[model samples]
Target chain A: MGISGAAFIAGAYEHPLRVIPDKSVAQVHAEVAAGALADAGLSFSDVDGYFCAGDAPGMGGIGMADYMGLKLKHTDSTETGGSSYLVHVGHAMEAIHAGKIKVALVTLAGLPRQASANLQMGVTDTPEGGFENVFGPTIHGMYALAAKRHMHEYGTTSEQLAWIRVAASTHAQYNPNAMFQNVVTVEDVINSPMVSDPLHRLDCCVISDGGGAVVIVSPDVAKGLERHSIKVLGHGEAPKHSDNGKIDLTYTGAAWSGPAAFDEAKLTPKDIQYASIYDSFTITVLEQIEDLGFCEKGKGGEFVADGGLISPTGRLPFNTDGGGLTNNHPVNRGGMTKILEAVRQLRGEAHPAVQVPNCELALAHGTGGSIGTRMGSATLVLGRD
Target chain B: MTEATAPVMPAPAPIVNPENKPFWDATVEGRLVLPKCQNCGSINWYPRVFCPECGKFGVDWIDAAGTGTIYTFAITRRGMGAYGKAGPYVLAYVELDEGPRIMTNIVDCDVDSINIGDKVRVVFHDTGSGSALPRFTPVS
Candidate 1:
């Protein structure tokens, strides 16, 4: 299985906060779907499978299929926060190999910044609300709890966390569509207003209104397409404890998913040329780097602090699209964007500023839900064919 | 001449349902209760219908010691909605002596001075709805 076309759609604004009042969530999804299909030189009729996430008015995937007029043979509406789309890629691959569907279109869109509507997923009625929300732990506070614990257990410094933001911002400088293009230093990130203990305001991902779509096809279908296709080498997904279940706050589902992905891909971390790990928070990237076997446990802070590890010319160029830290978050469905960037990198079409030279293999990883409580993770390995 | 009065603090109220009614009822009396699986001796948090460890329905409520250590914490300088007005508060997970980490708010201590592994004891704050919310304060 391979990805034939990838397209991202959002308002043209460089400011960190802007609302696209005119466009609804469905409108954005339709635009991105058309663009992606066109990129692959295919039409709507060519798509036989549909996958989507996020809370819309009705059933997630059914709503999108109705709005886009996509009559599909297979559908998946898996909702696991930001990592939903990455998991979709794995599901699509399995289904294609089994002859369940020939062409699958995975789409994601949200309007969090729009004043006219609220598209963020509702969490008040969830089990997390019953157990954790009573104490007033904001999403940032939850991730901050992990950061503080990491600092306490591993002697990680706030300076090292700031470096993660610095690396993402540096990559954002080349992405004209990124929310924040100004390069910031470690001091700037550390001195920014504290949203929660150990997490500065700059440590959080920017909220934005955007959407993205990707077209996946079986090898035979991909062979017929004129566009270049990126091979889906292997993938894995895992769910940690439930909302109220006991969890090791330092470890994430990535610990299981990452190794499973690498094993199936038959490749080690050393073979990866580029990475597009989720960046809902700086600690997220740091945790995934260590959990994905890029570094030893508790050595993530030191590994990331090393000069240019995440830079364009560094040992592992990651989040080349600026990531959620600076780029658009689009209702925290960043896994979709992560996949989009990995496809671009393998296609040799990434922006020259953040492109890794001679890039052959790339990894896309996503973490969803609160870090302190329960969450899910998905990892994918893609290669140029 | 008129005088202005202080506004009432706005905090989210805990949702009490059929599955968790007993847990909340016990808190009103200033006792912390958790579900314990008699089959496997595994303590469960968040109140589940069955034992997550043993997958048995022989779970029973047991009184906890109310003493624990801070596993992790965050000082929230900004909050959502009414919580925003109550800035610089400590939100933390306290690992109970019974072997379960529970989410709580740490009170009666400097938010900046709190550290992981700090000993804490449970304290109840009245929610004005006849139910007391369980919070933790450093055990000096």
Candidate 2:
């Protein structure tokens, strides 16, 4: 029961800003900021805080904020691989609670502009007593391990795992901004080249260059800012890490956190009419729903096989706009899509083809770390009061 | 003085703490041993003093049967760091005949020979130093 103002925008990078630039950072930030402000029906001055996920070149949160011609009251350049933006929202909400700031503009830009075969990118600074990446983990291989673990435990067959791709493509076919909108079936997912064992090429989300932003203000700030407020009903977070020892590759904390958060927000799975789960891999989403109590743990494999969500009328309309698996994965842009879709449903602005009836409350969940051994999850429950 | 760019990670070194010495020692000795709860008799790897099941610190090292099954594996295309040059090698999880899984390399066979649930017999290879790494091979 908290936040108020929120809007989102997405656009292809490497366009328009060619010659006079440092990798099109500023121009890209402005385009997204404008889109967000426009969606919320506000101007730039209303944004006093900034949160960003990308650290490409010399750009961080305040670095981009200053160039956007605004003095940021609060900022976070929090980067934890892919789940940064979703995690940032939890941080921003905490700041809002402190009453130190209002109105934050969050943005992300991870674009691969023409691939080169160079190994060394810029080195990263270790955070204060943060765990090191000594395990030599890749995001892809970790997801493969998770798929295998889920298969080992739940009797979740590889064929059932491929169904996630089928469901995602079916929805993305109606979404133009989606990178791979071609409609495909389960056979396509199975026949696809193996990227990691048990995880085929279609199992992984695409890597695309894009930017997205969302503007959120506190309830007090929202009264004067806009006519409608999609109140943040609840937020929850859980992390998997320890400076010492064995990585247990089972049991997602979200299974516990989802119920805990719903209890706090005074909501239930049934009340959530539409959901946008981070789909870095098809199997991850199935695990999240099972663990989050959308369905029983072993039952998820069957849920997907039964065509649980190919159309709006399906049991639970999930990732209504193509998810990261099919849609544009601007990294942080993935989180923005969910926040934007929730606001659209609350405002009844979702394209009629995939709109839900009375989608009052929405759920957006995000998790990161390639190997499921180290997992971080944040769930957002928002509603139209 | 200027603020210097910081290192993203600490130097990668083999980890050793008070509780893990036995497990590390066994790896160097070419013996696969896991701590079994002497009180409740539960077997587990990556050794610990306290038994997870019985909440007792009576667990002690026992030599495990080297035999296991290839629960799952991947012929890694992208090798990592020093290991990257050893590309297209199989990294597998072996579910031991004694009821525990350990992540180890699967060798002594071609890529086409490995499949899920295939029987594996363990062999230990020395690093020419005091240490050896336990790896498994597909059972004929």
Candidate 3:
């Protein structure tokens, strides 16, 4: 299984205070789909499989298939919050390996800014609303709980967490489309308004309107194609119990998914040349770095405190596109962007400033939902062939 | 025209579905109850029909000792949506003496003074909807 083509597109609106308010999620998806197909030198007529996170009224894949006039042979609409697309990539790879589909397309798009006026994906009044939502804990607040616990249990400091934001903004300086490019210091991140305890405003990701698409094909189909392809060496996914009563807030599903992915890829954390771990929050990157076996458990703070590990010129470059913290969150769905950056890094087409020299293997990981409660994790190992 | 009014804070109300009705009902009487399994003695929170550990439906509601310790907590300086108007509050996970950790808000004290592993006891607050929601406050 290999990704033959990929495309990332943002709505033509870039105002710091206001949204573009022009394109719908479907419109963004359609454009990204067409662009990705064109990049693959293929057309909608050639797509046999469709996959997407079901964030819209109807299932996203079915709606996309109808909108693009593609008669798909397979469709996957997995909803695992931000990590849904990475999980989709794993599913698409399995289906393609089984000869179920020749060319599979996975797409994601969201318009969080226009959600108020447009068809918003409003939170439904579910059962958990009574238990969890009643207390008014913002999404950041939930993750803050994890950060507090991690600090309490492992002696992690706010300064260490602030460094992740600083690193992200540093990378964003090279990205023209990033939401925030201004370099920030640890003191600046600490001085920022507190959204929740243990997390400053800069510690969280920004909301943006964007979409991305990736075209996956069987190895044979990729071999026949003219464009360069990146092999999907391995992938794994895991779901955590959503009920806060049962979940251990300090740990996440990545503890399971990361090991599974590494085993399947037959590679250790040392083999990775580039990394694209999700950055919905600074603590998220810390947790994943530890759970992915890059460092010892509870040692992520020390591992990331120094700028060299994740800096572009360092041993392991991560989130080269600035990540969600400084780049874009796309309605809190970061898996697509994570995959897009990994592909770009492998193709040697990443932003010149953040490009890892002689990069060959890249790892992209994603986390969805609240880390303090129920969360989903997905890991993918991609390699240049 | 006139200035826009601030949004109303959302009331703390629990959605009492059929599976979790008994738990909410007990909350109204200032009692905390959990589903205890007859087959394996495993206690379940958030209401489940079958025991998670034993996979049996022989689960019964049992009273809980309202004492626990703060497993972790966050002081929300700025809330979101309706909660935005609610002001700073403490959101935390309290690990009950009986074994399950529950999501709750710590109340009746300064939010910044709370610490992990502090002993806490449950206190019921009226939702103004005839139902009460359980919160925790530090115990001396």
Candidate 4:
């Protein structure tokens, strides 16, 4: 049978993850968790299984285990690419299946803003300790490579790429925490000094220091918890590469994850009222839209054009929090923000500036891994019912 | 894969991810390669030892056409770390004629004149490691 779950009380910490200066990853988690518990009207005692998706190796589940003094009934410190927290839901569900506990906590944080983040050149971790670093392939360069490939194949325009930045910037206007709220046009995106070939500084995701957390309680326990509960509904995942590139860059494995999730949730692209997609980059969302069965594969660029995904007139709005591009990307906490916004919309608490009315259903998807190959994607659907 | 240059860096040692040994070998020798899964007939990337689509282990390496088009690109005005000297370079995504798009750098032409869908062919840019890095050049 397909995976099924009950009511969940979730929390989202949207503070400028880069806001705090000198906060350790652990401090970020503790602060985010405390804020999350307060928002959920619950205390640390209510949490049983601890999960931390923070990028730093030491601060995942073990970090939380040390912090809250959790007995560690069932803990998952899954450090998959960026969509890791979404993957946490999958692990948490398995723990529940194993009868480990009734409540679970997931958190993410980093120091991109404080300049404490190790952003000397490329990716956060270089192929596990400089293995790939010496290759001269930084994360931005890899992504820059992918972006150029996407453009060449589909005849996608830099203007088209700018469309994503424009959409995000427009969305950021309402989100005070968003760093670049000032309106930036397509010309601005194109003119921005290039960081790598085909990738401008604006095209790349900024490294910032920030943290966010979410709590998941069983249906039975969730009923007594504060705030309107959102059921897990369904979760699914797939990978094109685990440690190395394994498949064609165009066709993706995320499509496999999306269909299973939609089938499990009994929902479709049209069924969703809004979507909070992971936005590490504009192209990441473009490819996921293709892979997630939202639109035909190559047609993604066209589908998103002409105010489609970027246009407010489009049916399904995305990345309600300005996404990783404009918002804080504290080690893929960008993905966590997607879930956080989904929870708020389900509870009818979205920012008044960009809230979708009667937002009963939503989609949150992520691609975690290097830009070129060996990607991981997770699809999740949330419903108010 | 090769010697360290101003932009491209050399591997401190050889890469050994299991599936991509051949790709690295070819890189050290200055050739671009990809993988075709035996079970699912899928062409995949990053040189995996197993098939990602069918979960089958019967996969082998194959060389690409070395011909493709520019999909998108960024002309770097700034560089970081060891690459700090490479302020104005074109990091490109090239769509191979065989249907897969690869992340690579574009060379041998003015970065401004390059646009999406422009024809490109593979060329070797020495990494100074002893082998040259595979880069794409606009086909005249």
Write down the TM-score of every candidate: 0.93, 0.77, 0.92, 0.81
Tell me each candidate's i-RMS in Å: 2.7, 6.8, 3.4, 4.9
TM-score, cand. 1 vs. native: 0.93
What candidate 2 gets wrong by more than 4 Å, as runs, is A1-22, A25-27, A54-60, A116-137, A241-250, B1-72, B75-88, B94-102, B110-134, B138-140
Q: Per-prediction fnat values?
A: 0.71, 0.10, 0.75, 0.44
> Distance from true position, residue A141, model 4, in Å?
2.7
Best by DockQ: 1
lDDT score of residue A98 within candidate 2: 78
- Indicate the residue-level lDDT of A20 in model 4: 69
Query: In order, what DockQ does each candidate have?
Result: 0.53, 0.12, 0.51, 0.31
lDDT of 4 by residue, B1-140 (tens): 22122343322343345444566567666677777888888887545657657888877678787899776666645545655565466665567887765556677676667877899998765554444456778898
Q: Lowest-scoring 10 consecutive residues by lDDT in candidate 1 chain A?
A: A5-14
Candidate structures ordered by TM-score, highest first: 1, 3, 4, 2
Candidate 1 residues A234-267, lDDT tens each? 7889988743445577778899999888877788
What value of lDDT does candidate 3 attain over all alpha carbons?
0.79
Q: Is candidate 1 or candidate 4 better by TM-score?
A: 1
Candidate 4: which docking quality band? acceptable
Per residue, candidate 4 scores C-alpha lDDT tens digits across A1-385 of 5666653645555555456666676777778878887777777877888886546447457756776666667778776667788888766766766667777888877665555443334434333322234434566666666666666677766677677777777777887787667767878988987666566667666566676777777777767766777877878888765233323455555778788788878878878877777777676777777778778777777776655654235645777677778876776446677788788778887777677778888878777776564567787887785
Docking class of 1: medium
Alpha-carbon runs more than 4 Å astray in model 4: A54-60, A116-135, A242-246, A310-313, B1-77, B90-140
Candidate 3 lDDT tens digits, A20-101: 5787777777777787877777788888988888654356577777878889899989889899988988888888867798
- Two-way TM-score contest, 3 vs 4, winner: 3
